[model samples]
Target chain A: MPSTTSTRPGGRSARVRAAVHHAVEELLSENPAEAVTLPLIAARAGVHPTTVYRRWGSLAELLSEVATSRFSGDIVVPDSGSLREDLERWAIDVSTDLSDPDTVALMRATLGSAAEGGCACVGDRHAQLDAMLERERSRGGKAPGVQTAADALLSPLYYRALFTTEPMEPGWVRGLVRNLLR
Target chain B: MPSTTSTRPGGRSARVRAAVHHAVEELLSENPAEAVTLPLIAARAGVHPTTVYRRWGSLAELLSEVATSRFSGDIVVPDSGSLREDLERWAIDVSTDLSDPDTVALMRATLGSAAEGGCACVGDRHAQLDAMLERERSRGGKAPGVQTAADALLSPLYYRALFTTEPMEPGWVRGLVRNLLR
Candidate 1:
């Protein structure tokens, strides 16, 4: 069993956690992901090595936590009255997030590794979408088939981000939402 | 400059080519792609080290070529009576192909490295799709918007294959096509 650093009785616990996460993001942004290690992260964060090791157990787990926590903030489901408008806004926001080089590298790192925890962020986002669609269904609106709509609208931005250098242009996002609704 | 083995006029030349491609497929199927190398591939292929080196200067380039050639066989554009029908068939076939473990590994390999040639295969498939849509438009069918349709139908398969462990069930494929058309 690992020591419970998050629950430890120290005023510095929260600061240490924030510093570690920020260090991970900055390292990922400036250097290759493979070069990042717990010791390196600890050194960058000004935390002790034993504390980092005790908390995370492994680099993959640490990265997984970082990815999930960082991206959970980005998955806010828009409730703009219409599913179409909501999807349009969601896709554009996601595209903007993926456009950042650091975000792209983080996604690439998560995909390259066999970390199940890394995909937890995407799963959370999916759940948010499902809830939105459920709300629409309860409102006497026809079921928009949210999973299929997500596949159609969201997958392309990911495809382009991972497979090509194509920009996820605003026009493309709008057209994708329009076509899915049509 | 690397020697042109493909242009060499010998019975062994073709045999060597097939063996190398088969070896690459076997290695990818069994091992982590990062651990694969030209020397190991030559050993597995039973071709000379110089030959593998001569043809592909780096592991990334070799893997990219393997990915492109293997997937090219999977991109058959169906010409059914209607765009909807054609899309349905294509989606199902692509889904089936992506279901194969070997095909999945090959895609994972290509994506783990920076290989522009690896993406050429997908580009070719997109072109085939574009041509099919163009033909439909010429036949007095409303322009079934090639890029948007591609995002709707194709990107989902790739996304699910890479991002999730979910089985691309046949019922799911049918439902996706129906929803897109609706």
Candidate 2:
């Protein structure tokens, strides 16, 4: 409870940032229907409201940042020995993560305002897919481009989670993995 | 323009509805960056603000309805002799339509709120896909179900449009069609 700046670099600033993001994720996952406001998020985060506004500017950007950090930090890119197995496992993982209503709400929240360069999570996913594909190629495996992975592997899951009522049918993710390999 | 109840059935009421929808489409497509409001749309449509509010209730609902009509009425389900060709053509058409910044904005505007049964445009698309697939089956042409068409054919495009900055690459739509046919 009584920590100094020595243990935590950037002192309270970094801790506050982490706390805000964690609070957002918890609030979203607990009740996707809850109207998430800056004040509410600040209260839950135990940070001043002014700090959030000064830091993130708007709720959309805050949500985008939270979503981006989630993709980059929370989830791990699969690195199975085989390209097919790796992509299949990755797709299933993505589908499972997106199947949650909270994640879907978070995803939807990140979009729909101004399409200024799209979301940061996309670039994050691309880097992730690139990492997976790079591992495959290093192992003397054949794989399609990142765009193909975006098209074949990840797009269907995101599209369903954002647009349709049905997220994933049985064996849906595996079929996508099979397509790129073929 | 002069109209009568005998000539236009619903007369002024139908005309007002059409005008408001046309206004929304124009405002959304012509300048997607415009801050679309009931007053703004009403002024453009030459209708009373109260009328729009009374009829549609909210901008999201209005946008959703306009999007539904565009999918259901404007776009035709491609009908080539072959299922592969038909699906490919349809995919290309969708890619082209969504290639427009206005259409992308319109599509994005339809989402990002409460995921109440997703969007109505989805139902319209499913119906169109079903119609196309039914024709293929009748002609003894093999085709996947509506779900497959959604995942392989449409999902990638929508995913790119909403999530990624790069929408459709050259020959990308055709590649999606190829995956399903094989």
Candidate 3:
């Protein structure tokens, strides 16, 4: 009974979650998946397969967990009071983050499952952007609507990362922000 | 000896090509692929599987062919004598085309094989944009660079098509064009 309640912070459950996530990231980065499986990740993480299955339920969910952690939690959304400054910084951060091979890999996996309902990553970004835009409106500052901001700012970044070879050019994001807000 | 050149217009090779493409479009629209195999397509088209494999080499190449035929050749890039008008027309054309379920299915397939070198569909759009931009420059009309045009116009269309449920709003595309130009 005590052990059942022991799935607390820094406890065995926390350790398992962390280890599985680390293993998933490592496996995803190690190569384009020739089938990155639940058992493979479990073995890499040194947790029992059932533990991962019982907790995450599937590979897609596990991949999504890792992605959600990074996109929604780890990456900071800027709040510099100016919409242009905030958007430029945010776009640049996104471009930088997506430049990582692992992120690109994760996106490839998610985008398929994501196609039906829309990308969770996009939802997270849309939420972050909505908050920033709301703040700008409250401060009596002019800002584009969320969809406009997403189209002008975010879509290009994701499009480049997923579908094109070109890097997001230096200072281009600032220019995009300037052009958009103007 | 004449058989070698039988790929001429309306010949057996042309017929086969048409049939195969028709089959692919039909099959793609039929379902999210539980693996849209060469064999399945060949059977549907009444062409030999070897014919599909020989002509297209792989499923990825076949998918690209279907995509290229639509995006580059079928979908006309406009020339309205004004850069803004041309861009708006082109953007609206793209938004309309990608709204189809079949294109979405094709995109899902291409995006995976396309990750390393960039999507062929994107290349087609870039080339079309470049052609239009070059024409604008020749006419002494100021236009954004091809990459800028792609970022401003094409990326948003494809991004929303592939990654979101929201329809490309009726007048919103025109507004996007004006905003980007400004």
Candidate 4:
């Protein structure tokens, strides 16, 4: 179970959560995923282990919170009146996010844990993606085969990011979108 | 350096390598990537630590050998006179290999090590892929925009295989091929 409850009386709790989330991101950026431990997170967050546990339940849950939080900012949606244009813009955004070193590291860590013992966080990612896709589908935007097209639009960025040592560029994402939707 | 060469060469040597590889695969299948260890691999393989060390420099190197061996079979390059058919066949092959429980475990372990210390084996996988692409390009059997098309054709299967807990089906590969090529 995740610790979603606010410890303090209202606005102050949000600040604490934000601080902890930021610290987790910073630590994940600097260290390998395997190196992150409860003690390190607590030390970096300037909080006690119990507090983190109370909030996020386990280290996996906390990491999931941090992972999801990184993408909580503005999401890019494509609406260029052309499916190609829409997909290209969306692909670029997804590619950029996947290419980020911190994002890649966190994903690898999460996936590694999933491989080990089935991380519940991966389900969260899927649900988030499904919701976003549902939103897109509900809109007037429709492709001939959107699900497969979307997978084609997004998978390469992640594959290159995770497997290859080189960073994936926006050009590759654009090329991928062009080839898939052409 | 990976321990590909043993000081003694004979039937026993071949058996030892085979035993070690099998052991590594079994351990990977049974345990999470983090739980796999040199001592455990040795015990499972029925070999001494010295032999394990002599065969592979480190656990990472040994695991790389295991992954390589698992994928060592000849790539079934299709020649059905159409680029789409060829690519679909390739995708099915890759999807089948990736969907295996052992293969998934190996991939998790490989990516985990890659995230931690930058596994050299990833370069090997890329080199193999590049070589295959180069061969196809030289053969001139593929359609226009072969490189981009190839990425679009194959990336989705690999991505789904890696991220999803469900086993990838041959139909999924076929759909990816049809959708990308359409």
CA lDDT, every prediction? 0.73, 0.75, 0.77, 0.65
Chain A TM-score for each candidate, in the given order? Answer: 0.87, 0.84, 0.90, 0.76
In model 2, pairs of residues that clash are: none
Q: Evaluate every candidate with DockQ and list the scores.
A: 0.32, 0.45, 0.44, 0.38
For candidate 3, give the lDDT of residue B63.
71
**Complex DockQ, candidate 2:** 0.45
By TM-score, the better pick of 1 and 4 is 1
- Cα miss at B154, model 1 (Å)? 0.5
Per-residue lDDT tens digits of candidate 2, residues A110-182? 6654455576545377777888898878888777888877878788888877777875853888987876778
Interface root mean square deviation per prediction: 3.9, 3.5, 2.4, 3.5
Ranking by lDDT: 3, 2, 1, 4
Q: Judging by TM-score, tell me the better candidate of 3 and 4.
A: 3
lDDT per residue for candidate 1 within B66-169, as digits (tens), equals 77787675567888779777877888888998888777777766654542312533646677667777888889887556676667767888888877778898
Off by over 4 Å in 1: A1-24, A31-62, A115-123, A138-140, B1-6, B9-17, B37-39, B47-54, B115-123
Clashing pairs in 3: none
How are the candidates ranked when ordered by TM-score, highest leading? 3, 2, 1, 4
* Candidate whose lDDT is highest: 3
lDDT of 1 by residue, A1-182 (tens): 14676566554677887899899889877765555678999999999989999988876667677778877866678999887777778888888987787887676555544423125336466766677778888888865676766687778877777777778899998988777667
Looking at model 3, residue B77 earns an lDDT score of 78
DockQ ranking from best to worst? 2, 3, 4, 1
The superposed Cα distance between candidate 2 and the true structure at residue B76, in angstroms, equals 2.0
Q: Where is model 1 chain B poorest over a 10-residue stretch in terms of lDDT?
A: B112-121
